[model samples]
Target: MKKIGIIGGMSWQSTQTYYKAINEGVNDHLGGLHSAELLMYSVDFAPIEQLQHNHQWPQLANKLSHAAQSLERAGADCIVIATNTMHKVADVMQENISIPIIHIADAVAVKLKQKGIDTVGLLGTAFTMEQDFYRQRLQDKHGIKVLIPDAPHRTCIHEVIYKELCHGHVYPDSHLAFMRIINELHFSGAQGIILGCTEIGLLVSQSDTDIALFDTTFIHAQAAVEFALS
Candidate 1:
């Protein structure tokens, strides 16, 4: 198997999920005693979060590029950025590394297309929700339609992601709030909901709702396994 490189710890909680899911995927594919062959450069999220909040994307991109270069030099075959929001700088990260960085949005788009979803709801950091990097890729590159919650709901989801989910805090009230937003998205003609934020899967899942829920953390991990095992 190829050695998968991960630039993680945008928030360690979701990074943990990526690590676990990728290993589980490999083990499930190869059976007993098999796990993913991987290397991870876990960054400190505090500075990264602060940069994001300040809209210091160029600085953030440099940081991510450094992490990807570290993984490449250490013998990782490909890279995975562990968070959705940070993918805004993915281009800079990719430019710095020779090995490919498996994009979370592309993985998600493939799954959505397979399910024949034409329109999907997105939930992530305010940057991801309001930015063009992610949604434009889905729409322009993959012919998918993207929908997001209204401004107030977008703010609520953003706060839940950083303040609550990133810190490993899950509350019933927060889940309820997410559910309400999901329902509204469904009513707004979303064929599915993309848990664009990696941490979101911690609070909600397919079992929590009838609308198709695409969790990028797991989907991206699964895609990494496919790349590694191929």
Candidate 2:
């Protein structure tokens, strides 16, 4: 198996999920005692979060690029930025490293295409939802239509992700709120829902929604495992 490098700990909460999912996926594929060959460089989310709020993407990119370089130096065969929002700097990280940075959106897009899902409802950090980096990639590259919650709902979703989910605080009210938002999107013609934030899977799952739900954390990790084993 190839060594899979991860730049994680944006919150440490979702990084845990990535680690679990990747190992579990490898074990399920290869059977008993088999697991992923992994290397991880976890960052403190405080500084990164501040940089994002300040709109200092250059500095943020530098920080993530440095992390990717460290993983490459440690002999990682490929890289996974464990958070969906952090993928804003994926190109910068890839430019600074030799190994591949498997993108979360691209992984999710492939699944959507395979399932014939043309339009998807996206829930993530404000940047991931509002920015062109993610939505444009899916629309332009894969011919997928991406829809996001409206202004009010988007604010609620973003706040819940940072203030609650990222810190591992999952409340019953939050679950209800998310379901309401998902239902609204479903009515708005969203064929499926993309849990674009890594921590979101903790709050909502396929069982909670009637429409198809795509957990980016699982898709990203599964893609990494496939690349590693190939």
Candidate 3:
């Protein structure tokens, strides 16, 4: 198996899920003591969050680029950025690394298509919801339609992600709020929901609602495992 590199800790909470899921996936596929070959460079989320708030994407890109290079030098065969919002800088990260960057959205798109889901409701940081990179990729590359919560709901989702979920705090009220949003999206023709933020699965899951839920963290990790095995 190839060594999968991870740029993680855009909040250590969700990175933990990526680590666990990747190993579990590999074990499930190979059986008997098998686990992923992983090299992870976990960064402090505080400064990166601050840079995002200040619209310093170039600086954030530089930081992630450095992290990717470190993983490459450490003998990683490919890279996975653990957080969804940080993928805004994926291009920069890829430019600085020689190995493939397994994009979270592409993994998600593949799953959506496999489930015959044409339209999906996305929940993530404001950057991911309001920006075009992720949405356009799904639409253009995968022929999937993406739906987002309204402006007020978008703000609430963003707040819950950074303030609560990223810090490992999952409030019951926040859980209900997300459910309401998902139901609304379902009414608006979303065939499924994309837990676009990696931390979102910590708050909500497939059991929370009847709608199909795509957990990006799990999908992305599984994709990494498949790439490694291939």
Candidate 4:
């Protein structure tokens, strides 16, 4: 199997999910005792989060680019940024390193197209939602229409991700709030919802809504396994 390099620990909470899901996917595919061949360079989220909130993306890009270089030097076949929001620097990371950065948005987009989902409501960090890096990739590359919550609801979703989910806290009120946003997106002509943040799947699932929900964490992890094995 090809080695999968993970750029992780943006929170460590959802990085744990990526590790689990990727290993589980590999095991399910290959059976007993088989698991993923992976390398991880986990970062401290405090500094990263500070950079994100401060809009210091150039520094963040440099930091992650160095991480990708380290993984490549250590023989990782390809890199996966474990967080969705960090993918804003994916191109930078790829340019600075030899191995491919298996993108979360592209992985999600493939599934979206396969499922014939034309329009999707996106829930993520404010940067991922408001910024063009992610939404534009979907719309321009895959012809998928992207919708995000309004300013207020976007704030609530962003807060829940950073304040609660990143800390491994899941609250009922937060769950209710997300559900309401998903419903609103559905009524607003969203064919499905993209749980664009990795930590979001911890609070909500397809079981919680009839509207199709795309959990990017698992989708990206599964894509990593496919890339590794192929």
Candidate 5:
């Protein structure tokens, strides 16, 4: 198995999800007690969260890059940053290392293609939603159309991601809010809703909505496990 590195703890809750899913997938695929061989550099969420709140991309890149370098030096073959918003600085993180960065969007697109989802509604932080790196990659590289909730709905989604999900908390009200967003996106033109934020699944889930839901966190975990095993 390949030694995959995870740069995580953008919120520890989602990082734990990655760790669990990766291990479980490895075991399932190998048909035994196999577990993923991984190097994890878990950054303290407070500093990263502060930078996120301030829109300080440069500082975030520096910190995350340093963490990536450390994981590389510790013998990780490739890296996966566990949060979607953290991927904003992924380019910078990759620049300082020889290892591949298993980008979340790229992994997500592969699954979307497998499912034949042409148009997807995205739920992520404001930066990830507005950023070109993610949406453009899905469009240009994967030939998929991306949709996002309208401004008001996006704000509500973002609030739930940060205020509740990050802490491993869930509220029915939050799920209901996301259900509304899913409805809006489906009405506006989306074949499925992609939970672009790793933590958002803590609230919204497949059982909660009628629109097709693409859980990026779950897909990302499955992809990481596949990469490590292959």
Candidate 6:
């Protein structure tokens, strides 16, 4: 099996989920004692968050690029950033690495297309939601329509992600609020809601809404496992 490299720690909460899910997925598929072969470079998220708030993407890209190079040297066959928002700088990071970067947006879009989903509600950090770099890629490259919540709702969701979910706190009240947002998307023509933030599945899930739920965390991990096994 090829070794998968993960650049995680945007929040340890979701990173841990990735670790457990990837291993469980591999074991379930192969049976017995099989588990994912992986290496992780968990960065201190404080600096990354600082860079984001300050709009210092160049520095952020340098950080991830260095992490990617280190993982490449350590024998990772391919790379996974393991976070959604950080992917704003994924290109800069991947350009210097020899291994393939399994981009989360591409992975999610592929899964959506295979299921015949053309439009999906996308919820994530404000950056991922509003940025053309991420949304346009899915639209222009994959022929997918990306739906984002409106201004006030967008702020609410972004706050919940950082203040609660990423902080390792899960509140029922927050899920209730998230459910309303999911329904808004459904009523607005979304057939499914993309859990675009890596940590979002830790909060809201398919049970929260009747609409189909596309969990990016699961989709991205499944893609990694397929690449590893191939």
Whichever of 1 and 4 has more lDDT, that candidate is 4
Candidates in order have lDDT scores of: 0.94, 0.93, 0.94, 0.95, 0.86, 0.90
| All candidates: TM-score | 0.99, 0.99, 0.98, 0.99, 0.96, 0.98
Measured on C-alpha atoms, candidate 1 has an lDDT of: 0.94
All candidates in order of lDDT, best leading: 4, 1, 3, 2, 6, 5
Clashes of each: 0, 0, 0, 0, 0, 0
lDDT for 228 (candidate 4): 92
How would you encode candidate 4's per-residue C-alpha lDDT over 133-193 as one tens digit per residue?
A: 9999999999999999999999999999999999999999999999999999999999999
Model 1: how far residue 149 lies from native, Å: 0.6
Q: Give a tens-digit lDDT track for model 6, residues 72-144.
A: 9999999999999988998888789878999999999988888899988999999999998789889999999
Give the clashing pairs for model 3: none
Residue pairs whose backbone atoms clash in candidate 4: none
**Weakest ten-residue segment in model 3 by summed lDDT:** 89-98
Candidate achieving higher lDDT, 2 or 3: 3
The local lDDT score (0 to 100) that residue 21 gets in candidate 1 is 97
The sequence of per-residue lDDT tens digits that candidate 1 reaches over residues 1-230 is 99999988889999999999999999999999999999999999999899999999999999999989999999999999999998899988888888998999999999999999989999999999999999999999999999999999999999999899999999999999999999999999999999999999999999998899999999999999999999
Select the stronger candidate by TM-score from 5 and 6.
6
Model 1 error, position 228 (Å): 0.5
